[model samples]
Target: MGENRIQQNEMSRRSFIVGAAAGTAGLAAAGLFSGCSAQPNTSTDNAEKTNSPTIPEEFTDGVYLTKAISMHGPINVKTVIADGAISEVTVLNNRESYVIGEAAINSMPQRILDSQCIDVDCVTGATLTSMAIQNAVSEAITLAGGDPGNFKGYQSPEPKEADVERECDVAIMGAGMAGLMAAWKLAENGKSVMVFEKMPYVGGCMPITSTAWNAQDTIIQKAWGTEQIFEAWSSVEAQLQSYREGRIEPDNPYYNPDMPFITPMFDAARDATDMMINIGVGFCPISDWPAPQLAPGAFSIGGKFCLDIVKNYLTYQLGVEIITEAPVTELVTNEGAVTGLVAKGADGTVYHIASKAVMLASGGYISNNELMEQYQPDELKFPLMGPPWATGDGLLLGQEAGAALETMDQGVTSHYSGAVSHAEISYIHYVCPGVVVNGSGARFVSENMEYKQALRVFKDQPTTDFYWVFDEVSRQGMVPSGNSYRLDYTFLLETGDATEAGNYQELAEKLNLPDLTATLDAVNECARNGAVDEFGNEKLRAMLLDGNMYAIKVTPTPYIAQGGLKVDPACHVQKEDGTPIAGLYAAGDVVGSVENRDGAMYRIGLTQAIAYGLIAGETMSAEL
Candidate 1:
């Protein structure tokens, strides 16, 4: 989802510029004028001559300023054009982090200047920043009366053939945390393992964010004195009830009949954590409510940390072979048994990996529009924010090999809790202590419902546009933890996504919510008197009054697919008749029913991936 988000952010920025230009045209027709027109000159004089191109006469000398949105926020650039050439390129302002965005900021502009073109290679690890600079420069060139498209500075790397190929005992698809862990385990057991990754680097979603996992009675949980929390919170009935909460229909076939299998899988998660720690993975403990047993029982390490340790151990210690930019195209099967698979390299070279066993840890199909429409057609209306490579490759391969899928309708949906304008950063405040209203300024779901449940209710809203209204006191208490605090409140305000007003009336006027003032009054009254509102939000009743108030509009975003190929508790791919597919195994997001126990509930994604990966690795190794 991290890589997908970065790409989406870039695409959105480009789209915004295009949309702005179209809007400017409409405004022009309406006799509206601005300081600068968005319409670009389409005259031949601004076009670049391919045979012998030179800087346009109009851009002979001047400084052009343009802004492009980076992964963090807007990046403003100053392009100095002098004597028919780019004399200097300077980044005037950006909110990018020094460690991630600095390299591109420092090196990309110089590359553009040296090459005398706007197109240049992006920094290896700083793709967003690099693209942002390129975009800013391109906008500057357009403003300078030059052909922005003709400034070809960034060049893609030449694709290379698969020069080496060999047989292995097991071939794993993907190099994500789950796939890497599976490779490490199998390789350590003296099995020759090969991993094929479609991406250039390891850690598909890892190295991009931090996530929590669920495990019971782990060393960390014991140390934190919360080892028994899971047993208390997670009973079989509770687990079943969790899955039944937010279904579109009561009779929907989303629930898994073999729901009890989750008990042992979570029980085995402690061993998975121990193995990860033994392999040098470090973790910090964090807490979440209601699911206390599931929350602090495991370690809270950033994806990058887990990826680094597992990748290093797999490559250097276990001697596992990993091929990046190699995507598995088909799974070879003989007499109903998996045998080998065909993969294509970046340069279109095909390599066949013959293996005794195959594991599919290739991730979910959230990024595949066709698959999303096929499985959960309703979800097609919502925006997806998962990795692009999660195109259901493993699921496709499994289906071709006679494996049945389960819980195809389930996926993770995240809420934009703060302000509609602050959608990008609203993910931070998952549980906003305030009243949530639809586009008509009327409350819908209870503000105190769990995040996932809230998402379900929000999705059903008439306009699908909502806001979180809170007082300054409640806002002060909204200090975020987890993978949510990338942007601060001030930044959100700067983006003009958040609305602040001295009183509810003013805020209502700004938000176009005619009934907002009355709604706010009622909510504030409930908060001041500790009275439960009609929504049964007793917890928020005491937290909403006093001081200035704010509103943040939010939209729904589906993060990861919760359904895929059906696998047994041992992580072996299973057919419809309740039999395992010989030599075929799957883990991670590729195995769908792992989370939606009864077809409704969701567990932590990383935990399910890791635990099942461990189980798959051990089971396959035992077969050897």
Candidate 2:
């Protein structure tokens, strides 16, 4: 109920700016925005331009423009302007959505240019392009004898109110499940908690997310009947205990209070649905509930559950109010102690929400072009998939408040095809159902690895381009499962770039395999054997085959940056010098995850969020 009120009041902040900037991009040559150059003479002196490397005669013929473009990486570095001279620039080359980028470019004026460098920000996913255009404008100023750093057009908006007035026991930055869960527990303990969200809506990335889980019983015994489920769970529990004592330590990333300690997680494959159900979430219970277990130690869960509904239910239960469209502009501190946030509504009105403590759940920079380039430069080859509002707002806010960022090397990303299936929607899982073939048209990966491992397998492939081939039967038979849905053969042939073939031989021919006969024989043999059985074939085969055949050219699309604000086990945002920032806390996606762990998102991971957010809230409330 509070989500609606916040959305109404904060209407302007909801639209994400990410991915709205550019159309798609190709592998080679990127696109640049063409507009009136910022009156360069206002900022840089012509003398300064010549003092450096003189523009060659060849470079002088045209204006040099720079544009940041999006590849698979959240941000990519590409120069539309070559040799610091304007190469005739065109907006059409970028393959991302053109409307967002074109609109920003068209609005680029001397007045706007005067305001800030790349301050307008690009749409999410197309961050590179946005930065490129911003740089291009700045470069133009440098060329025209204006200081690139001196900009004057748009006056930055000021905060609506000072931060010293408001007060709360706990302040949460997001209204997502984790945040709500934390608030619920804290409020029950009598904490005055408030939530701040940049979007009008409160749910962070969950409304559209598909929810699936792995449980202790589901994997150990492939039984769907609820009756036998507990026994299977007990068995898993026993095995996990053994593993914990033998291999996993209490502090180990995978250690879960719910499961027995085990070295190999595969031994305890149980149904994740049981746990989610216990937590007040629902899932489809058909045999799919106890979805097939991946290889030993490989676990998975998949179900379609809209997050919007989840958010509504959670808000009602938590009794915590949310403020949406209120992008936090600053962190207020006194005497080197954290206090609260300086935020602005979409209407440009700002306010200070004082709090005993603050949790930065504002998400990451997968949508920030400038930050993306500063981090994963190599990922520039793929298009981005992130919420536009995910523009490092919380990260910057935390940093300004004396919080130090960490894990620049890690990001919350998984793999997808080169082309984005849907940029605006969050639930679209781009798993292609066809047989994966390497550059040599050879199948290299096990068909039923866990989604993370499956994605990594493809990522670790020698060639960037692979093909996903499936047939009509395969499509219809395949169901949308997991947080990200996989394509069944039918879906592949009907939509997307899947290659259509009449028969296995024809499909093999289309895929450019070395020999159609050999490929077909191998596939048939595997199918007959019920899918790579040596690796647990039936469950793998059930998810792999659907028929009549189609294929999609696949490449690695990295989403989610794994690293951000460094927080201790207690969820306290820390400084680079290793001191906790007073009155500041972090949770959910904005916080750094357990280090060096591949299975960070499983049960133990969410437990960490819940535990830390609880600690922060409790500590803040106690102080109050």
lDDT of 1 by residue, 324-437 (tens): 878999899999999988889877778888899999989888777677766766654455555557789999999999999877666455544233221344343443456778
Q: lDDT for model 2, on a 0 to 1 scale?
A: 0.49
Model 1, stretches more than 4 Å misplaced? Answer: 1-13, 17-67, 75-130, 140-147, 153-164, 207-209, 227-258, 285-301, 347-349, 415-423, 430-432, 474-489, 541-547, 598-600
Candidate 2 — which residues are off by over 4 angstroms?
1-165, 213-227, 230-319, 410-412, 415-434, 478-495, 515-517, 526-547, 595-619, 622-624
Write down the lDDT of every candidate, Cα atoms only.
0.66, 0.49
RMSD of each: 8.3, 14.8
lDDT accuracy of residue 473 in candidate 2: 51
RMSD of 2: 14.8
In candidate 2, what residue range of length 10 has the lowest lDDT sum?
Answer: 295-304
lDDT of 2 by residue, 313-426 (tens): 445755666777777777878887777777777666666777777778776676667777777655554455555566787888888887887667644454544332322211
